[model samples]
Target: MAANNLRGQVLSLYSRLLRMSRNWNATNPAETIVERQYIKEETMELFRKNKHHSEPFIIKECLKEAEARMTMAEHYRNPYPRPVNLPKRSFSKKEGKKIGKAIQKFNEQSRPIYIRSTDDAVGRSS
Candidate 1:
């Protein structure tokens, strides 16, 4: 499916990024680091430009190559924000049904809301 291909592409891209980061870390020389970063940025940019037409196989292969270059030293940063201890929103089915019924009743009693076609709406504005 198209969704599966999209997921694969994203996963591959992340894997490739991690690998390149590891390789850059391993070299440690200033010039190599800069070059590596530049190359990685370029690769990401190219991917962004042509992502619409990119095949799943190409994405997966690129990711595998990138992963091969990755190192443990490059993995220390936290990829996610610290978890917030916020209370979760809870809603019951009965509450949802009640709200839906109320909205339906209000809509039925009110004048119909008209949404003009995009071209008609734009022409009226002009």
Candidate 2:
């Protein structure tokens, strides 16, 4: 029953993504065609490639990724994927280089730290 629900969710998300791609329009006239094509092609290719997976966890993860991408696209008004790493030019300045080294050290040293509110930590009540 849960599997059937997950399948339905995936199909619904896929349909919405396709509709979004078909209707995509960029603010820049020159980019509308390119961005629209990219959205459509990427959506179709990824959905087709992952259609064989029967695992609910994997499907949920994929759905989460698709939803996040849609939210980001709408928020940023751009459909292109974000870059995983900063461009080399970003580290060309002395300050930038220092910041880059700090980031690298942090990445190598530990897991991300999540800060909680003092009220939560102390279990405070009004």
Of the candidates shown, which would achieve the greatest TM-score relative to the real structure? Answer: 2
Off by over 4 Å in 1: 26-28, 54-126
lDDT of each: 0.43, 0.66
Q: Could you tell me the TM-score of candidate 2?
A: 0.65
How much is 75 displaced in model 1, in angstroms?
Answer: 20
Candidates in order, TM-scores: namely: 0.33, 0.65
Report the C-alpha lDDT of model 1 over 12-95, residue by residue, as the tens digit.
766666466456533446556665666466556545644554566555544443333232224533211123232233222364
- Give lDDT tens digits, candidate 2, residues 1-126: 999999899889889988898888898989988888888888887777668778887677667667877887888998865434434433333553454666554442232111101113222110
With a 3 Å backbone cut-off (N, CA, C), the pairs that clash in candidate 1 are 19-70, 22-71
Q: Identify the runs in model 2 with alpha carbons over 4 angstroms from their true place.
A: 85-126
Count of steric clashes across candidates, in order = 2, 0
Task: Give the Å shift of residue 21 in candidate 2.
Answer: 1.1
Candidate 1 backbone clash number? 2
